[model samples]
Target: MKNSRSKPFVIGISGGSGSGKSTIINEIVERLGPEKIAVLHHDAYYRHRPELSFEERTIINFDHPDSLETKLLMKHLVQLISGEKVEVPIYDFPQHLRNSKTKKISPCQILIVDGILVLNDSQLCELMD
Candidate 1:
């Protein structure tokens, strides 16, 4: 049941907070089968700012694209497309910082990237199929 394609098909989903993007993604994953797809959340890529206190981090505008480490995400996307595994960052929502642990994701036939500002980045948009 593995994907036979040489490269995974990348899909980017973007929307504002409280939107139905997550719901839509869930439906798609359910219909397509989760085993055949890999999902990357932009929220998980939030920059790890250890120097900033929890209060300071909370004050930072997370809605801005600058708050995310898009470069790292881009690099990981490239690697996933190349059939390589990646250790994705785990963000602590309450603390507004990245946890020391990471989630290891394997390349799949379909790659779904979702975030509020995912499509806002020109370079990141270029990577989508």
Candidate 2:
């Protein structure tokens, strides 16, 4: 994991879409302050299905785990676990995909992951174990 190389503490949060994970994250951020913590959105992990265009991906059942880019997310997860800096892709919900530029993240004391189906993948489940 790019962010975990330093053995940083990890926190994973999951829920249905629009489940207010952000609100909770914001509250935690407020309590912890920007300096003490870091957060990651699972949407950033989505694999780029170049074969599937934005329209096709959007038409699919996004609420289901199959719609996610599990591979890419796993890569980032590995990086975080390994304690390395990562440039997380910014996924566009409206476009139903990630853009080119990515947001840079460096592991801090605590790393929080929030998303809808992040834990649904068997790979991630194993990682969680």
Candidate with best TM-score: 1
lDDT of 1 by residue, 40-125 (tens): 99999999999997789989999987899999999999999988999999999988889999999999899999999999999999
Instruction: Give the alpha-carbon lDDT of every model.
Output: 0.93, 0.72
When superposed on Cα atoms, how far off is each prediction in RMSD? 1.5, 4.1
**lDDT by residue (tens digit), candidate 2, 1-129:** 133444656667789867888888898888877775767787776655668876787777766676676767667767876778788888777776678888988867677777888677777655542
Q: Which 10 consecutive positions of candidate 1 have the poorest summed lDDT?
A: 1-10
Off by over 4 Å in 1: 1-4
Over all chains combined, what TM-score does candidate 2 have?
0.79
